[model samples]
Target chain A: MSTHFAADTTVLLGRSMRHVTRSLDTIITTAVMPIAFLLLFVYVFGGAISAGPGRYVDYLLPGILLITVATGVSYTAFRLFLDLQSGIFERFQSMPIARSSVLWAHVLTSVLANAISLVLVLLAALLMGFRSGAGVLAWLAVGGILLVFTLALTWMAVVPGLTAKSVDGASAFSYPLVFLPFVSSAFVPTASMLGPVRAFAEHQPVTSIVDTIRRLFAEQPVGGDIWVALAWCVGALVVAYLLAMATYRRKAA
Target chain B: MTTKPPPAAIHVEGLQKSFQALHVLRGVDLDVPPGSIVALLGSNGAGKTTVIRILSTLLAADGGTATVAGYDVATQPADVRRSISLTGQFAAVDEVLTGRENLVLVARLRHVGSPGTVADDLLRRFSLTEAGGRRVSTWSGGMRRRLDLAMSLIGDPPVVFLDEPTTGLDPQARVEVWAAVQQLASAGTTVLLTTQHLEEAEHLADRIAILHEGRILVDGTLAELKALLPPAQVEYVEKQPTLEDVFLALTQEHA
Candidate 1:
């Protein structure tokens, strides 16, 4: 049974990957927003913002990567909504395929596609004078962190995908996701903000995550932020995964 | 020792299902013998699709016992799924994939070996070889529906459920689909189909079950169903209005 599920997931994953490949726009769309932000921030506001010594692009790149993940997850919801509205989910359910394979295939595809978008935005950041001194192990750690984060967000997207009344409703949930990083340490440090807003920003999940990535890129010591970031990502993943599967069971029920 | 063949390819006893407070299937029962073409006739929202969904394992039944290919739907869902195929009310083919690719994908999902050959065979059988390479999004509704039905046959399961298969089809496409369904039944594939078109049921089904309000109002051959009502004239013209229009007129006057 596990073999059957693995095979079915592989086939469906290939189908989803093909869809992603054909519409280069999905990847292009995900990368474009963060690339635009990187270009605008580094060229227009880089000199003005006091992000300590080094380059402003370096500080900004980490946050841009987070934003890239936020924007990319919207496509996951959009694609899932389309598949639902198109009645493809019903078709898959009837076949002798594994039930969880359908969801896993989409989740896996989201991870792969978002990874590409992250890479694209990073390349554009390099062009804008962003540099990272993190070695192979640090890079691997960053990849793991981003994968967990993307998986968490993608599963959250699945809930809306299954339950939303309209296509706009499905993708609309991601707007707050994309907007979240700005309030964190993405652009300016939370320490610079006033009382309550600064407190809220310092406590949020994105700040720790962004701060950790920023420090890692600059070869600075990242102490507690890394642990907090992983905890947040894993916590979100667990909650969202449970919620998504519950929604799926209700839908299929 | 050889025993008499089993009751039917599909057997349902006291099958009951509900959604929240609304009971969708109220103790419905059915026994569809092997190789027989059974048509389930009902109005919209009458639980015909719901029944089909349950049989195909897409939805669970609140209460009842249903055995497809001798596998219980609730207890042995995977086995039941392995023995059946379903073509839903809408064409469920992936528009992003080409016609041939869609068939190949389903074949692979069903664990068919050399899926390429199975796909090619189905494409040729459906007379879609010429259009095989083009995306399904470019195909006409009739073509898409045909491809959807063809995909359902990839695994060659014993029983197939077609829920309102001709709902949005043109006359020509409807006839084509009917022919394909007829071919499937003739090849000894037990078929359970739901349709609003009485003429379709009359022409296709060896046995018919009329469901109203989620209960089996009547079940028999077409002649037996017609026997339940008074013999009435069916007006026909060279180019006539739809049966739905006439049905609405007659039933509406009675109401």
Candidate 2:
């Protein structure tokens, strides 16, 4: 990439970061539902759900973090949709800046903002007596996994941002994503689920990611789940990036 | 003895665009001389904005070619973009940002030096200095339009396209924007602006092109275009005061 690409992306990313700072409520709102779910499931639904040996909060933190990322990325779609509606995209396109930098700026902003939300959620998890005995490398691995997961979901958000006709439609795409964790081993092991539902829960991407993170957090020997989780995250990110770029080109053209 | 003027800063021939069955521009041709102002006059849905979009490299033409500052828009879009700035029908400023912040953002993106200084200078130029530090959401329509225009000028591009730049502004604000465009032209920038108000075109454009039915019906100096229409017969009547005169007089007095 040329130096201009990096410079232009930084400038545009500054614009998006300014928007995030000005509207603190978006970050707070994104974290609120996931934190509430964390609290509710750990407190109200904890005793009833069979989570084997570990505390339910420990078992559930990985899924709640994933949910936090899922909820946070919808704002990326909403912001992109607003920029499209306001005609700013046209303005930016006409400039001499790198074309791909426009999308990159938003993607980076999503990463930064979601990273903060994840940190906030992690702090709350710790307050609820959730503890991880994993070494430094394991913690780093968990962070890496979360970053990949967020990148995949954020790119997925860009599709509706470019194509949705209305604000509600842009953000509503995240609803199913937030729900996907429930059917997985997030709340309870897939073994306890009925045959058909269990099959789906085991096969979906979320289960692999949650299972991988759960094992790492518990300092267990993470086997093939790590590879499977990486594959899902990387696969989703590549596909979503390509699809989002196609939508952007069609719209901007 | 005067040397021939430089090649046209903007040249287009046989430009065509359509959305499915709705043909917007059909074989439209235009030329804007360097350092001159050309006004595009057309009714709603007359393809004026489409022409601007194509020239600015924001949209591709289905047929024909357009060049801005000697760069073909189809093949050399980056070079074309390097020479042009565009302000759309709506004030495209970011509402969440302060006016100064918006200008700085554009200046920085354009790779200008000392973006803060550029923003400050533009704020003063557009009489937005007082509101420079306030969020654009609190700005009036006129203020937002001025800020939008200011942002477009950050790069000091040689060619500028204003698509109905003063569409929603009040009369006073409209005059202010017109003055800014006039200044831009005087400073050797090629300007192509679209407008619905004949008076606006008359007041600012060195030449006017009337777009109708997906093509330019007539294009020339105001006097030249007037010569094309059938002359009105002479009439003798008592002199009467016009409403425009009365309104201007009243508004001027109030001011």
Best by lDDT: 2
* Window of ten residues with lowest summed lDDT in model 2 chain A: A1-10
Whole-model lDDT per candidate: 0.90, 0.93
List the candidate 2 regions with Cα displacement exceeding 4 Å: B1-5, B236-248
Chain B TM-score against the true chain B, each candidate? 0.88, 0.94
Candidate 1, pairs of clashing residues:
none
**Candidate 2 residue-wise lDDT, A89-113, digit = tens:** 8899999889889899999999999
TM-score of chain A of each: 0.98, 0.98
lDDT of 2 by residue, B147-227 (tens): 898998998999999999999788778878888899999999999999999989999999999999889999999999888
Q: For each candidate, C-alpha RMSD in Å?
A: 5.1, 1.5
- Writing each residue's lDDT as its tens digit, candidate 1 over B25-144 gives 999999899999999999888999989888888888888889999999888888988899998888998999999999999999999899999999999999899999999989998999
